[model samples]
Target: MQRYFETELLDVKNFELPKEIYKHAIVVMRAKVGDHFELVTADQKVHLMEVTAITKTAATAKEIEVFEQLTELPVETTIVCGLSKGDKAEFIVQKGTELGADHFVFFKGEYSVAKWDDKKQKKKLARLEKIALAAAEQSHRTTIPTVAYLSSLQELTLAADEKGLIAYEEAAKEGEKGALVTLLKEIKVAPKETKRPKLQAIFGPEGGLAFQEVTALEERGYIRAGLGPRIMRAETAPLYLLSSLSFALELR
Candidate 1:
């Protein structure tokens, strides 16, 4: 079943679909009365809704079943990526959402090649938001991840706070490992009963983080962690980190 999001899905017993959703379901998808689809409301409830009526400008659906499912990371992990060139940020956001990232943040790294001015930043953010929404629906996620941009490493660290990690290539070469596993172990216990741990991991752009940036992160209480023995690209690192999180937190 297709999934749609509405802020007021549970406002009434049955609600008229939004204009964009109505057009997609009626005109593009050719959905008719009696068809069933999923609607995620403001409170993050997923309901199997059956179409009750359709008009030129509106479509109405009522709940048939409420799904008691949680398709999110056990820990509230946020990926803070250093700004990279081209569509790298888009790729990261799309795949990262599917892989269960709670939030995505991009910052201006010292070695970053791409710069986002005010106008372009807004446009890029809008595009990334759309990609995240589509990916969330396709992956059957209950919530769409938030996307944000920051100015510097200092701002990023402040936003993430003490519960953060930095993916450094030197750590990989140094044969340092298990930092993430240890962190996950400390947070993944009895997830249903315990408060969700908020974690943020930072990654560098094309040239990777400067030594001073890594040191600064360490000084700010971010533990330096390695993905594995292999080095990953600007886009690949976040996907790898998210997948690892799934393995440690969800699959295990």
Candidate 2:
């Protein structure tokens, strides 16, 4: 069944699908009256819905069942990456959303070769947002991950107040390991009255982070950690970190 994230589904006899969703549902998917799909509302509740009626431009659906389950990460994880060249940003956002990232933050690093002009920045971000939405829907995620742009590493660090880990290549060279596992264990346990803890991991661009950049981040409470002994590209590091997190938190 198709799944859509809908902000309006409260106390309504019938809910109208948005224009994008309607076109895909009716024309693309050939959705008809009595066809079933899933809707995730603003309250983060998943509801089974059936198409009640179809107009020329839109389709209406009614809730049939409310699911009593959730499919989110145990800990809210955000991946921050330095802006890289080519389609690496899109690749990160798309795969990261499917892997259960709560948010994606991109910042301009000192070593970044690609620079986004004002005109290009808006278009690029919109495209990335759409990719995240599509990935979230396909993955059956109740909540779509958000995409953010940061002007600098300082802004990125200030925005994330949780456990911040920098994927430092130097750390890997020095044989640093087990930091992620220890941090995951610490955040995995929370009081009954508290929500899950948040974690943010930062990765550098192609040339990697400058020494001064690493020092600044370390001074701001960011822990230097390595994914493994093998060094990864700017795009590969975040995906690697996310996979490790899923294995530790979801599979274990």
Whole-model lDDT values for every prediction: 0.86, 0.86
Show how many residue pairs clash in every candidate, following the order shown. 0, 0
Scored by lDDT, model 2 comes in at: 0.86
Worst-scoring 10-residue span by lDDT in model 1: 154-163
Candidate 1 yields a Cα-based lDDT of: 0.86
Which 10 successive residues of model 2 have the least lDDT summed?
187-196
Model 2, span 135-160: residue lDDT tens: 98899998889888887898755444
